[model samples]
Target: MTRRTWPLRAWTLVALAGVLLLSACGEGRQSVLNPSGRDALLLYDLARVMFVGALVLWLLVGGLFVYVTRINPREMSRRLAEGLIVGGGVLFPVVLLGGLLVYSLPLMQAPREADEGLRVHITAEQWWWRVEYELPDGGRVTSANELRLPVGARTGLVLNAHRVIHAFWVPALGGKADMIPGRETYLSLLPEAAGTYRGQCAEFCGASHALMAFETVAMAPADFEAWLAAEAQDAAAPQGEDATRGAQVFAREGCGGCHTVRGTQAVGQVGPDLTHVGSRLSLGAGILGVEAPDFASWIAHTETLKPEVAMPSYDHLPPDDLTALAAYLGGLE
Candidate 1:
């Protein structure tokens, strides 16, 4: 090869290798390869088998190339060529794929979650998830941007979208399902460990589709029960001077028109329920911290941070009112 061309090719290979190495370096629990649940493990195993089978096929082709070019460069008999074509090419692929189909299809089925367990209904909006827990008692608690599941239990999920289609996927837990408009899709994830995992909208819905994400927290059974009980309760009253003023600002600005806070008159269904917003892991559909400052920035820069969102930017609010509003919302826990 020419020297100049060789250097360019070498650089390309180096870049590819760098990317491959970097992709393996992840600390987050959002990888199917590092599965945290049963269905995810099944998927991982099936993928491994498929990958290994494909690798063997490729290696066989490479060996054929070496045999024909280097070991013995001679024309084969027509009879031998036809036999290779029929046996190795046609029959081999049929058997391989048929075996794979037989083995892998059953691994894809989700087991029954439970005879009596909590059910989660998730509705996908343009760029956020509206999460609701259907209690065994028939009452439902509304939440957003975060999902909590009890470890060692299969929790059933009913997913749908508001206006457009979206896909729900938690890589470390299980496969994805499409969330269609006016149609419900079902999935069940049984987490084996108590840890935090990340989930995202896998389908391209609109402008901020890539930014649509949520946190999944697999908790111990007792802790999950307590948290669910707390979630069903009304939001705690805002405390402190700033928080009280913030509540007033929230009312004055008519923020309740799109959001909801259970204990107050701020009941609106257009946006997420803010009854316990402060207790959430993140804000703005899991894109920002739940801290007071994060809330302040979101109130001021909604359009800037998330384009085409339903919530209008409240950048016109005065600085004091904004701060107070942030304080009040942050104290909703």
Candidate 2:
């Protein structure tokens, strides 16, 4: 058989062309190599260039082996051995060291300047997210499960954990950052467009860690301001006779032991604040939709959906009582 250099080069070019075509499609949402932030995109480009260069090196070395082995069997003993050593010993280290240097360069540079517009604190708990926003007027508001920010503005996030380790990440916005118990970590992201982004607890904290999800809503500045105002309003309890009965059940049945809703009593910080939960996008830490049947099922039997959850089943309640309670909680908006 004769040595062939054409095949190796052809394959390398084909792979490169495929990558270019994928990039050209602007599949930012689906592309692994596509990056949203300036820092991540810069790093991704450098790494991709290095990867292509490495593939070319591999092809050239492999082609050289084919050349020596086939063209002259007599010289193969010496030439092939020397080629193997030189290629393996010299090229491998150079490629590895080169890649390391390329990846480390950006780490030494100072981080980008912090944007003055938005700042929010995120704290990870056992099975939920605690989000706090620092407003321009020096006031702070805290909520759970859902995060709302001004669209197109650069936002700085400070991450912390109350119990165990967790990772905070929103794939569309940026990469992940660890939430350590005692240490605070910071990440900055700018949502280019206004929409909803889904995120989860990347670290395994406990049994319900997978259920520990959160949602981010990026809205226009005017809309965001309106949302903030609405969230800050005092709680308004349900007024109808059925809703009044439901409120009585909530107080009698020990629902106040874990959750909180402003005014009219029921203040327990162990779980999420239901003061404006009806107005939020989703419920149960984004596990279920905020609809009548979903809420009814979840309140009636949580363990059936998620085994060993902190909240036990309220399965003993009668159907009418369950319906009334669900209606009352739904009216919290």
Candidate 3:
């Protein structure tokens, strides 16, 4: 190729790569820019305004620098210099900053207003989330790894930590609130659309902190009500010989000491509630999908998927027993 053509081709490749990289940031379900809730949309709007304001400020500064360096000092008047100093350096910044503070302070306080809709309690552990929903009858339903909400409902989340500090953040929903030990914090979200969003622990807690993620599903009012009803019920009885045998294995393996499944003898409260484990979209705090193969793998090698996790590996179990156990858990839906 000719030299001119080669330079053109190189520029084209660089432009293409830049476009591709920018596209990746726009496509994720967890991106704050693609907000789906009222608070998130407000934050997104503020971000856009600030971004544009920064660009304008940069251009003005650059222009001033160019004029100063290119023009002769003798040609510039003393009044012009003083005007630039006061206007650009002091008054301009103070006005801009004051306006921003005024605009954002109210948004920060909006979440603190009373919420009359659903209330959820989320407790952050080393690498997982314990989710509890307050029912209308004053009872509570507990679950893990997945959070469900009604679209267009103002849901209040009461957040706390079981051990160390963590941050509960779902970018598409709203801003994050810290989950601190010995203290309870709150965040309010009003999802505007029905879709699935991803959430993660924004603060680092331990070795598996990066894997401490969950899914947030926003459904219609009717669908959300039905889901709540099902979740409030006890786990269904295991069917068939394989599933029955698997339930027996689960009890014999001492899995009941850390986990709980309603309507069963397993009543341990140290781990995530597994009453509807099969109904969850993902397993192990969003590390893997809820499927037969993934379930078996998680059971056989918990540490391999999540390092420094509290659960022990059950690789010593025979292949048949493992398969049966996986089958039984997968049928809990």
Residue range 1-333, candidate 1, lDDT tens digits: 863365457657976997899688574688886799998888989988998887677566655655666566799999988887787778877888788899988887774333356799999997888999998778899999999999998999998999899999999999999999999888889999889999999999999998899999999999999999999999998899999999888888888898899988988999999999899999987789999899999999999999999889999999988999899999988
lDDT of 2 at 236: 82
Minimum summed lDDT over a 10-residue window in model 1 is located at 108-117
- Which candidate tops lDDT? 3
Summed over model 1, clashes come to 1
- Write one digit per residue (lDDT tens) for candidate 2, span 102-194: 776765342234567778888898778888788778886668898887766777888899978999877666667899999988887766567
Alpha-carbon RMSD, each predicted model: 3.6, 4.8, 4.3
Q: Score each candidate by Cα lDDT.
A: 0.88, 0.75, 0.88
Q: What is the lDDT of residue 69 in candidate 2?
A: 63
Q: Spell out the clash pairs found in candidate 2.
A: none
Model 1 stretches with alpha carbons more than 4 Å out: 1-27, 111-115
* Top-down lDDT ranking: 3, 1, 2
Ranking by TM-score: 1, 3, 2
Candidate with the larger TM-score of 1 and 2:
1
